[model samples]
Target: MRLEIRMSDLTVPEARDKRNSLASRTDVLDKVGVLATLPGDMHTTTEMVASFYGVDVELVRYHVKANREELDTDGYRVLTRSVFESEFGSLSNLDPRARTIALFPRRAVLRVGMLLRDSSVARRVRDYLLDSEQRIQSMNVEPLTGLEYALRLVDAEKRVLEAQARAEMGEKFKRAIEGGDGLTLREFHKKYFSAITETAFMEHLYSKGYLINQIGKGAVRTEGPKAGTRRDGTQHRHPTYKGKRFFYLHGGGIHGGKRREGTRVRPGHWELELRDQLAAEGLAANENTAGLFVIEGGNSKGLA
Candidate 1:
């Protein structure tokens, strides 16, 4: 059975509202300030910043760009510079007491002073911010304080891991195809998708068009006729070797049908077929598929 999934779309107004709310928050400003202190030439990008801040990249970029624009504005230039100097200076001096005092605006100097009198609480706050910045950097993404930025980093990391896993699976599948091994969908799942359900796993490959239909059920055929049509269908008949039946490809929704009299199931035939297919497709049989596998590699012809 096939199902169509729809993802909700966000409108410009909704996006703007979220951005405004994120920017007004003090925590966001602090994070942005810290990120600004880091070397600009570093490998960090908008995606990395989003991941570090746990915000969506789009949202993080919006706020960061807005913040940068604000900093460039004549009205905000002096205040922004002052904030940066104060934060960095306090951090460099290793004076948590002075840091707390410098954090507040001029109007709140008295209140800040009163809080500083309690040395322990002031130190805790300073330490918390510093520690937070460190944690953000370790993620290999630029740190931002905005809630949106934080959310982006979380999503980016998730995307990265997912991409890595898919790439690995695709490479394994490619090997199986080239090697002419007779691996069942179940066996493939045990090797790769053991953590996921069979139904979901099959659906994922089907949706990606990595596996195509053979006979009636889905099989490991690549680049063939569309469903309900057969004019351009590609079919493979397994060859017997070492008393085993081995097909060019395997590991789809379908397993081999019962053979005629005296024909026995071939063991490990499907795996060999997969390896051979990978070689034929110009992909290194031993290439690391981690996080880079995609159907067609963004080309018009799928799964290269």
Candidate 2:
């Protein structure tokens, strides 16, 4: 005997609500554990937040988006003041401290299931359902009968499944990185770091302890100036040790160059000792400390 699997038919009201919920749910889930509830409107919401704090809307959005994960987990209403304090370091910056005292309303309508299973089949189902609803809306037929709407919903689910399969296959690049096979610098860069700017790249390395301070002037003159320049008329530096060159760290923001303050300079000890140690281990071949970090420390070679 063969077992047949089929989805049960949905009523018109059920189908419509499901479709709307799919879109809403996806948006919320994308930011799950990051936002407590949905914003009324992405644009207007930013403006509202800005007005509340008497700051530029763009800045408010930037801060909000950056700390979305923290906000969601902590609960927006409960953590709003803390989030602002952590981001700006104090409420003293605001002219009227009382304005910053207000918290966001906690009654945000969010379905936890949507956010948790974003990469699972549930997301695909929502996408398809929403697409079907959109198609139905575009039909320009006034008052679609219940049966027609249901049929559209079914068709949408089919499309969503096809789209999901395509998306699943598209994640092969990540799999490649996680696999342990030898990859050339060019290949690895293409697969991972190509889209990241030099500064952002360096910041990431610095955070990981793979890179330290900006390359000194003496090193730059000897090693040949890098492609970019720092504000102090020095060429941006790459990771190096004991005159051996390693990986190149880009020194800009992910999207582009922006002033980044409070980045800790590389400690003198890291440059003197850590560089020599890695070199002694034969990890810094041809001054490729960055590559060694990826292969050995970063576990890049584990990708098969």
Candidate 3:
């Protein structure tokens, strides 16, 4: 007897339930290739769907073709020869004419299972599919309990704090580089030591017993807090030497140590000018040694 069926006779949910119930069974689902398609939108052939339902492929195809409106609503497409070859190229053992109307997606398989209500396997699959969907949904929403969520939140907060600290350190490094070894002289109110004048700063270093003129490159602190100006015109304390309280003075002055061109003999009396100022600051005669100094190669007497 031909299995007479009418898809319209079943309710929408009823038809879905019928299809899904069979889809959930691993045994029948595996036979149909639908079991292997978990977590992915997979496809199955009419032959496979028929095998899962324990029905003839022709009978399954006949009902699907007759009720195309309802069953082919989604993911159903008839592939052309080129499409079949390109997409299912690796699939072997297909019929000679299979490429004429090629692949069937998962929807087609589910639709077929719905239509073949007479098969006992189809009924079981429908039940299994419904159960599986519920189980999957139950597993989807956060698997964590209250304590687990709280612990995860705390870890996330710690990570955010660590990121903030790193960002602060990076900003400080940029500022230090901008400031002249943190001894960058600035023009503040001239009222009372409002800002350390270049001369006063150098004198202070000399007073602390450091040679003011022979200071070298290693005197500047690159990693610590360098002199930085804020957007509001406020300035922070300049970087200081790690051990001593001496100021790191940048090299270069207007007193005439600079050579214009061609003249090797001191063109300007800048060194004398510096020496005179250090003397005024009560510096010992031979003590201008903290800043950059030139070692006279010809004679030790030429050393300044």
Alpha carbon lDDT of each predicted model: 0.36, 0.38, 0.46
lDDT of 3 by residue, 181-265 (tens): 2222221111113344656654554455433233332234445455332221111122222111222333333557652211011
lDDT of 1 by residue, 1-304 (tens): 1211111111122233222322232343333322221111112233333433444646544543444433232122222434644433212222333322212221121111112322333234334444554576587755577998889989999999999999997667665343432235454444334565777654544443434334343344455565454342243122222112122233344336733221112234344444354346443333432222222321211234
Indicate which candidate wins on lDDT.
3
Error of 2 at 67 (Å): 22
Candidate 1 least-lDDT 10 residues: 2-11
Cα RMSD for predicted model 2: 17.4
Residue 147, model 2: Cα distance from true site in angstroms: 19
Off by over 4 Å in 3: 1-41, 129-304
Arrange candidates, best lDDT first.
3, 2, 1
TM-score of each: 0.17, 0.26, 0.33
Q: Which stretches of candidate 1 lie over 4 Å from their true place?
A: 1-63, 66-188, 192-200, 204-304
On the 0 to 100 scale, the lDDT of residue 87 in model 3 is: 61
In candidate 3 the C-alpha lDDT for residue 21 amounts to 41
Candidate number that wins on lDDT, 2 or 3: 3
Candidate with maximal TM-score: 3
User: Weakest 10 consecutive residues, lDDT, candidate 2?
Assistant: 2-11
Clashes of each: 49, 22, 18
